[model samples]
Target: MTELVALVPAHDEQDGIVATLAGLYRQSLRPDRIVVVADNCADLTAEIAERCGAEVFVTSGNRDKKAGALNQAVPAVLDTLPDDALLLVQDADTVLNPGFVRCAVDALDEDEGVGAVGGIFFGEEGGGLLGLLQRMEYERYALEIHRKGNEAVVLTGTGTVFRARVLREVRAARRAGRIGGGDGYYSLASLTEDDEITKAVKTLGHRTVSPDGCWLVTEVMPTLPKLWHQRMRWQRGALENLRDYGLTRVTLPYFGQQIMLGLGAVALGLFAVFTVIVLVTVGWQGFSLFWTAITLIFVLERTLTVRGAGRRAVLLALPLVPELLYDVFRQLVFARSLVDLVLRRQEHWVAT
Candidate 1:
């Protein structure tokens, strides 16, 4: 039997830690041990985790954030487990469905070349407009991952399972100066360590997959500003990770896709600004049939894409203008992220 252990890196997550632990306890395939790394928590995070029966390791003098905390905690417990043991890294605020672990384990067991498996994340319900929008976004994201099958370019941090030996190999490579070095298995330089590790795993000739049945629910940002900052870090972090690894034949298409999307967003923004200028100066005569057709096509595409979001999503889609506005907002966020990346601006992690 393959031994399984879970590592949760948390910082001031007192309110959700108990529920997270309970969710794991109720898994169809339970792990042998659950370790919670309480990094610089001012609340009852450590206390709650201990009360819930998790082995807690409180981090002191570890200022590298989630990556650093995981680095410190994972090796300590992982050293005791066998090479074939599975290591699961889950977010403090996430709740996995009972089948999640079972599905993830099956995925890893299915292929010797598969190093990691990430879960499809569905946003928790009820937060008003922002929440609904985020839920819709997650639906689309999950759908895409399912359609992509076993090939996952980016492994999400919400919940991911890894083969212990693969992680040990990654750690060895880091120590040998083949990859960037940090405190542990994960690197602290990138804003999104999960993305960085995904690239690393691929470089070692192992595939990272996400199975549709392995899904979890997580909290979504309740406001526009919060969502903006969260996405900004993600976008910039992706860029940094790619830059660090240097583009290869396998990564070229992925990089190209992102560049194309960013360029398209810039084009759309300029067109929108031009259309507004024309409307203000030349009245109704300035309206172009070409732009109208393109707008309708985009609205239809977005509406169809979000159809899985339920009745409320349908109602939200009924107003095509708002959906278009939201797309513009997303485009602007991506654009800003590119600018920040070019300027070499540093973005710190903030729990969302």
Candidate 2:
């Protein structure tokens, strides 16, 4: 029989630890074992996890952040499990729907080609308007994956389940210089460990997906500065990972995505310049009825995609200006990351 095991990598997440653990306990198909890997915590996170009846594996002098913590914990935990056993590597701050584990595990069991099953995550509540916007963004992403027949561009870190054997193969491939440098299940050098590992799995001829019913709610940055940093890290890490791997069968789509991002940024910049020119030289003309109708159609499409997010999402989408501004914010983030890549700027990893 295939056993289910969970490894939660946490760092000073005392407040949210209870909710995360509770989510696991509420699972329809609970893990046979739950271990929390507390990495450099001064808070009561470890004690809380232990008190909640979860086994704790406290990290020792580990400074490599989340990836390093996982590199240490995954091997130690995998050592105790059968190669066929399934491993759930989830963030300490995330909470899954009751059926998430069952859904993900079933995805793996039903398909031999899939190496990993990741969550379709929604934004957790709080953070005011910023949080609401972030939720809308995540909802659109969820809709995209759902519409694509559950194909995933990356195995998200919020929550994911992988076969122990596939993880072993990932580590083995790393050691043999097949995918991801250094010998570990995750790449410490890459800022986005999840994205790098996704590439590694697909490179080894295994597919990854975000199956339906595998839902999770993850943290969103409360402020613009924090959100900027988080998105910058994501975008920069993606750019760096693609650079490291170069153009190949596994990375072509990724490259195309980066290209689209660049083009979109350029287009936005051109639009801003055109608006300025029109305002100064051509003078202010009344809004075109035709353009207004076209804009409404665009907003309607956006609203339709996020219909699953509830009525508030529809209400928010109806007001086009706010979401358009938010889109510009994202475009700016992408532009900054592209600039960093061009200059070959080195950024030290800071926990987000």
Cα lDDT tens digits for candidate 1, 1-352? 9999998999999999988999999999999999999999999999999999999998879988888888888889889989999999999999999999999999888888899998888989888987888888888888888777756767788899999999998998888877774636998888889888988888888998988888899999988888888887788888887788788855686699688878889788788899799879887785579988897787787788888789888778777766667777788878787788888776777766
Clash numbers, per candidate: 0, 0
| TM-score (all chains, Cα) for each model | 0.93, 0.97
Off by over 4 Å in 2: none
**Which window of 10 residues has the lowest lDDT sum in candidate 1?**
175-184
Whole-model lDDT values for every prediction: 0.86, 0.91
lDDT of 2 by residue, 1-352 (tens): 6898999999999999999999999999999999999999999999999999999998888888888899889988999889889999999999999999999988988999999999999998888888888998999888888888998788998999999999999999999987765798899879898999999988989999998799899998999988988998899999999998889999999999989988988898899899999999989999999999998899889889878767887888898788989989999988888888899888766666
